[model samples]
Target chain A: MLSGEGPIFLQLAQRVAEDIINGTYAEDAGIPSTHDFAIFYRMSPITSAKGITMLVDQGVLYKKRGIGMFVAPGAREHLLAERRAAFRQQHVAPLLHEAELLGIDRDELADMIKEKDPS
Target chain B: MTTAIDIRGVSRRFGRVTALDDVSIAMPEHSLVGLLGRNGAGKTTLMSIIAGQDRASEGRIAVLGHTPFEHGPTLRQIIYVRDNQRYPDDYRLHHVLRIAPAFAPNWDADVADELVDGLRIPAKTPLKKLSRGQLSSVAIVLGLASRAPVTLLDEPYLGLDVTARSLFHTILLREIAAQPRTIVLSTHLIEESASLLDRVVILDHGKVVVDDETEAARDSVVLLSGNTDAVDRVLSGRPVLESHTMGAMTSVTAAGAADDSLRALADELGVQVARATLQDLVSAHGAETPEPLELKKAIRV
Candidate 1:
């Protein structure tokens, strides 16, 4: 599932971040070790470590000297806030561009988004 | 990290054929390096030289700072199993299992047993009678179970089934975590094994075409596709690896990073752009070149 266009390490970091945002890992909950990540992802240990390190650098994950890595306190809120800031450019803009190409007006797009059940 | 294996201007010749030509690569210790190339691209020749099984015609190789050829101490710390490994005429799986430990000082018998069972190798069958996939399984058993500090695997996935391949990967990663060691694996299954590599060294026509960290290599090229004229304009002044022209559309693998200006031009010209994958890079380097693996500036990654 991690196989994407960009570097494997970045993809891995994004996946973990998505999981945190979804509550798969709660605050102070320990994530899998680097070795476990490598085996599960079929990636090298070094790559797995790099991905984990990136999260640590971003303040999303924190390391315990002898134990393992755990989700940083307030990491989910931090990631949600960050993603919300970029949601316009990453999701809404291209979406708007496509809607424009399809001749869907702004009002019609708003209506389309408001409709919950499209039977 | 200190260098585990170092090759300096290593060249190998067989009669009139030049198998390796002044190749040099310094592999960092405890890293998993993917040795990739097309068939007969001198990958095997280079592996053999590093294993001390074959000597270079010109240049030298140092493993752990000691010349490997005919050096018993150094050889003991390294394990190299060829793709087409051969056993005695009457040898069987048990025979190999019993004798391998004598050579590999750091061998782990439990790892061997786990692999043999995981791969479902026939223990009673004669060595010569095993099928290609079975032979590959046996080679993997030796390669990983040996636990050598410097392990060289030449085409370990030659004939492995999907299940067996998955098992091999799991076992390899587990072993590396338990015992950090330098491993250089050569294989043609680029995408399947790309993630398992920390670094990648691509060879074509006996020369180092692309050598860089796997993450860096993946970001070193960009793919552009659109109308022929538009793509041609954006691709101008770029070293193209592979290009396809179908009717009015053209798709190309352009070497080097795609700068903002280039991306802007491509966006304006309706040319879609994406980062090149590892498979794309290897195939691009393998593609016929004007000067046989040219694009020297593109190798920095």
Candidate 2:
């Protein structure tokens, strides 16, 4: 699950954020502890702790004193908003870049997207 | 954080050959540090010195604030399971487990039993008759079950299969979390164990090559490959660790992070730029000529 570019902690943080955005963790629901993440991901406890701490700092996750970490309220919406804001730069830009190199015009790209849209 | 194990200017000599040369490392308590290097890179020698099994020809070592050699109290708090640990003649697995608690103050019988079954260590085979992997499993049982505050595992994964290795990783993470301790594990499997380490100490030719947090060490260099001219231009004057060229294609592992400008240059030049993985870093530093140890001070954390 951690096979990605950049530091492991950053990849872990991004994964948790994606999970939150996908509703895997409901708002205010408790998530696994740092140690749990370490064991599950086969990574060091320090690295897991750093990833969780980053989320806590970003208001995406919150600590409940001795209980454990929980998905902060509105965390899903916050992450969704953030992802949506960067969607073009992170996803569409790459798609368009590859399309241009393949000599595919914007109209053809739009047609391909429409044809692939199942719903 | 308190220092768990401290080595200062430690060097080990085997008659005419030098095993370790003026190596200094201070590992803080509860840190999972990776001691890595090629075979005969003095990994075993350094571990032996730290575990009090052998004395350094020069310098000093402190484990838990006291010298480990012949120091009973300090030695009791540390556990070092050698890769080729020997057992008494005709000793069975049960016999070793029975006597282990006598030496380990924090020994946990439940942990030992769990590991025995989990690793599928044969109960009836004599220790002397066990295969290399079986012997490794026995060592792992002792290492984990001891639960000492300071643990040193020298090549614990030797001869282990893929499934066995994964089980070891799971068990190690769980044990450390339940009972936090300082661990220094030496391994030849770099990428396999890289994720489990928060701190990394790489040695080459008996000298510390890179000592830093795992992520920082991986980011300290960038891998570039493509046309020879494009790669060279992107590298510019940066220090190259290791480089290979085939026909017009050149691949270079260069020191320093791939900054934004460098990335832009690489993109324009159609050269691939990526962060160096832990394995890449280790291999590059391993192949590098032995630079003066003084030059390595800049990479130390």
Candidate 3:
């Protein structure tokens, strides 16, 4: 999916992150090379490489000397932490604000969560 | 924090044809600047001269306060990534990764290794065996990991897909934010990369046509749509880059901000005013100059 209107490199970085989450690139598996990505996407190689490098910086992926890159060990945990932080910032706080407006308390929210998931 | 590139009265010519004409520009440090124009607008030639790959027929160029030609220290601080890069036939992706650290003082092996995994590049695959996209990936990795103070990417996104291109934009911004440097990106995808640019330098027929902050350049061109007569009256003696007509309606893109009086007059005439986009500005200027590709073809014939 197209990211928000911004630099092309950022959009590419998001796509790679999404791909990791979606399992298009499995943990510990090598992703497509920059040249391959460029040819597949008809983009410049440098552009494709930018996306890969961003993932590396985020610790979602790690490199192997003389070998191709692999999904870093504990990458899923790292991603989960990041996603949880984002969820709280992007969704939970706003949700809490609306709950306050509706006069819902901690017990009511707990009850709703319990009803949604018994286990 | 000084200017990354400084050019004064720079000119280049190929026989009777002028590739760059008395051009002068100072690239600000730690900013992403877009070098834009139609094909053969001297974008490549100017970049080449600045990178020290080619010499300017006249004038002077200094990168990092040193003349770039054969200047080892200065050259190392600049990375020029282009589509036409050549590699030895026997060389493989591994070779590039291996030697990158030696040349790039700030090279991050971990970043390179992570890229290799994410990109799935074959370590043993020869350069000739790799696909076009694979070759481009090599260039991308080198450019980013090099961490040069002055990084010039010439159409670096040519062979990438939408997803890959988006990733590139993200990484470039994050990296630059973490480690600020001067970056000059040349591309035809104006609208896509417009926001990333701090400033834009547009060339027309080897001459600098538009050089301004990206926002200011966008602000200088105003688009107005209204009655043809009223539009014509306001546009008279003003610099109008382009105009379109449909029956009694006319849309004129005039250079400079619309004054209060002109805005009021336009409103009285039922004219709609809007900001002109960078693409619109470039298209309007490009139309005024001879197409660079056409000129090259003519010279060839």
Candidate 4:
């Protein structure tokens, strides 16, 4: 599923974070070990560990002294808060930038967004 | 990182041709390295020198802190398996199975049996009687089952079909995860085996051109595309690895040209920008690239 989209580990981190948001892994539940992740993805264990480590650093997952990694409490909330903030930069900014380039005013842009809005 | 294999100023000359010229590479222990290069780029020569199959004409090599030459204890811990392995004309697969364990001190007979069965290789068949693909399978079984400290595989999946190649990859990675080791897999099927490598070493004209972590290697190049003049203006200052022009649209692979400034230029000049893959990097580095290989390409041994 990873096709040279930046680094493999960061891509893997994104997938794991997405799983947390989608409720595939419950908060406080232990995620797959690096070996399991490597086997499942058919990649190197070293690569998977890097991704897991990234999550650990981000407070998305916590590691016990000897035990494996577990989903942090409120990880979903943390991720949602992070993604919502990113939504403005990733999805909102491009729309606004294009609207400005096309000379579309504020009300017209809002109207266009509402017309095509899924909600 | 602890170095498992350290080679310095290694050179191998066959007649007038300098197969390996002042090649030096140090592989960290428990790392899977992909040794990649075009034909006659000295990958095989370098592997042979490190594995002690052939001696370097000049320079030094150390495996596990000891020189590997004349099949000593240091060499015993390393297994070199190539796609087209040759055995005595009289030896059969049965004989090889009986004797291979003696060479690999850490050999696992059960793993060998499982892989042989998994690959559906006929153990009763003579070594000379097996087909090319079957021979490749036999080599892979030995390489995996050996579980050696250092494993050198030179396109061991050359003739394997999609399923067989996938099986080899699964078995190889599983074994490594269970017991990490230094493995250098040399192959021309760059993209197919790209993900399996932790570190990648690229050779061109018998020299180590690029050696870096696989992630960092892929991130070093960027693709710029769009109208010819727009893309050209955006790519002007960058070192263009390879570029293609179809009609008025131009696609260029630029090395070390990935930055916010470049992206802004590409956008302002009406060009598109994207990341470059390892395959793109391989073609960009050196050597004339042939037509792009299919997703599933078999290297003929």
Candidate 5:
């Protein structure tokens, strides 16, 4: 599961975030252990841990003493907020610029969205 | 930066075989250093001596301002993570984590927790039951999370796949950036890790063949490829490491210049000049020359 050309830890962090969004790991569920991830992915544990540590630093997961890591409370909300902000910066502005070039107004976009799903 | 490791005329030997021959080098603090060589080229021997796992037959080694051997406080500050870490049969993944903090002074619990969770290491699985890749991962976690001032990782990514190795490199850079420390990495996979290293220390046979800043080391050698006659003309009077020829085409590795004169000479001879890689430089050192008597004498002192 490779993505962009950045560090492996960032890719892993994205994958774990995806897993959280997709409900693969339910709210408050414990994440996999470092050794299992290493064996399953055939990666060095340190590399896998780099991803997990990223999530912890971002407050997406919290460690339980001597137990393991669990998805933090309100993690999905936090992720959604982050995604919304990222979407505005990475997609919305670019889309607006493209739309301006194509002469597609906000009303046209709204109509297109409505046509795709009336509900 | 202060010197984290200061090796002065250090030498190690096993009976008639000389592993290190009076090699002296100083490792600056908070930089990623690459220790490079072919198999049996005294790389591991030198690392072992600095880590205090093996004693040098001669010379002096100081890690963090103290002699490494049996110096508990100094030894604790240096973590040597290798492919062959010994664990008892009954030991499990949790066992190592449980005891790592005692030795690693700067050990970060949060980093350890994240790593354990990310790797998905089954806490209950015994060390013997884990696969080779898993074992390598365990070592990586300890090495990184330990946060020792002088972290020595010798081929820590041997069994890992490309993705895993990439992840390791990324984490290493980020961690080192966040908490600067003196790191010594010994690996045959030089090209992949080349960019991460601030400097390169190359050992040939039992001596320091090339020790220089990464940029300087890369710039010291020039590769010229063209017609055999043309390459030979340009290579004449220069120290040639190795050469290969196919049909009318020949490539020669030589130590000389990246100067305009050399570039113009290569152009005149229809030879293409390229910077030599660290791997090429190591290979060109001629597979470690036979240890000289002088080096042996220096080691004894």
Candidate 6:
């Protein structure tokens, strides 16, 4: 599941964020601990901790002190809002730029998007 | 942070050859540092000096707060597990594992038993009769169970396959999570164990070259490719480590990230940008080679 796009920890952090959005990790529910992640992924505890810490730092996960980390309240909504903006800027914007390079106008791009829709 | 192993200006010589030269690095408490390099690049010498197996010809070496070489208390707290661990002529796995507690005060027999069951190391098999993989597993068991305050694993997986190696990584993390300790693991498998390292210290020609957090090391170098002119124009002033070209395509591994303007230019020029993995960073520095002529200089004239 990890790619060489950057450090494994960052990739793992992004993967966990994706999981949260996909409803695999429900809001206010405890995710796996760092030790469990290390064993499951065959990664070091340090790496796993870095990934989980990233989520905690981003407010995607919250610590309950004596207990472990739980998905923060409104985590899914927060992540989805960020992901939607990211999709627009990263994917759709790039696609439009490429289309522009190929001499396709905004209308043509819109038409192409509509044609590709199954419904 | 408390320094677990403090090495300063250390150098080692064997006969007329210098194995390590003027090296200094401190490993903090409860860290997993990777010592990476090619074979015969003085990785063994540097680790041996830190483990107190060999004395440094110049400079000081300390484990915890005391010198390691020939020091009883300091040596006992450090476990040095080598890939080619030797045993007495007829020593069986059970006989060796039974005697492990004498050196390490923190030895855990239960952990040893658990590792034996997981790695499937035959307890009664004679050391000589064990296959290469099984022999390596014995070393792995000792390393995890010893629970030494300072543990140095010098490429402990020699004959292990992928499944066995994965077990080592999993078991190591599990044990480290239970009890925190300083670990300096030297390995030829750079990327394979990259994710396990807190920091990576790469050696070439008996010297520490790249020693940084696993994050910074990979991020410091950027890999770029496209037209030769475009690649050179974009990363002109940056330190180019590895460069290759075929026809019009040129690939260059350079230091530092490209700024916004540089990225825009690269995009305009069709230059593709990529990030370097830990392995790419290590391989870009190239390998180490000993000088035959300088061999005589290591000896006292």
Every model's Cα RMSD, please?
Answer: 4.4, 5.0, 13.3, 5.7, 13.9, 6.1
Candidate 1 structure quality by residue, lDDT tens digits, B27-94: 99999999998898999999999999999999989999999999999999999989987688899999
Q: Which lDDT tens digits does candidate 3 get at residues B242-272?
A: 7766666777778787678778877777778
Residue-level lDDT of model 2, residues B1-301, one tens digit each, is: 8989899999988999999999999998999999998888889899888899999999989999999999999999989989988788899999989999999999999999998998999999888988898999999999999999999999999999888899899989999999999999999998899889999999999999888999998888999999877887898878888877666777878889889999999999999998888999988888865332223333442
Off by over 4 Å in 2: A97-112, A115-119, B288-301
Give each prediction's DockQ, rounded to 2 decimals: 0.90, 0.85, 0.03, 0.71, 0.02, 0.73
Of 2 and 3, the candidate ahead on DockQ is 2
Q: Choose the strongest candidate by TM-score.
A: 1
The pairs that clash in candidate 2 are: none
Per-candidate TM equals 0.95, 0.93, 0.67, 0.92, 0.68, 0.91
Ranking of models by TM-score: 1, 2, 4, 6, 5, 3
Q: Report the Cα lDDT for candidate 1.
A: 0.90
Instruction: Count residue pairs with overlapping backbones in model 5.
Output: 14
Candidate 3 CAPRI grade: incorrect
Q: CAPRI band of model 2?
A: high
State each model's TM-score restricted to chain B: 0.95, 0.94, 0.90, 0.91, 0.92, 0.91
lDDT of 3: 0.77
- Cα lDDT tens digits, model 4, A1-119, are 46646678887899899999999999999998988887777678888899899999999999887898899999999999999999999999998998999999999978877896656
Candidate 1 vs candidate 5: the DockQ winner is: 1
- Which runs of model 3 end up more than 4 angstroms from their true locations? A1-119, B119-125, B129-132, B289-301
Better candidate by DockQ, 2 or 4? 2
Judge the docking of candidate 6 as incorrect, acceptable, medium or high: medium
Error at B196, model 1, angstroms: 0.7
Q: Residue A78 CA error for candidate 1 (Å)?
A: 0.6
Fnat, model by model in order, equals 1.00, 0.91, 0.00, 0.68, 0.00, 0.79
lDDT of 5 by residue, A33-100 (tens): 75455444433344567678899999999999999989998898888888989999999898888899
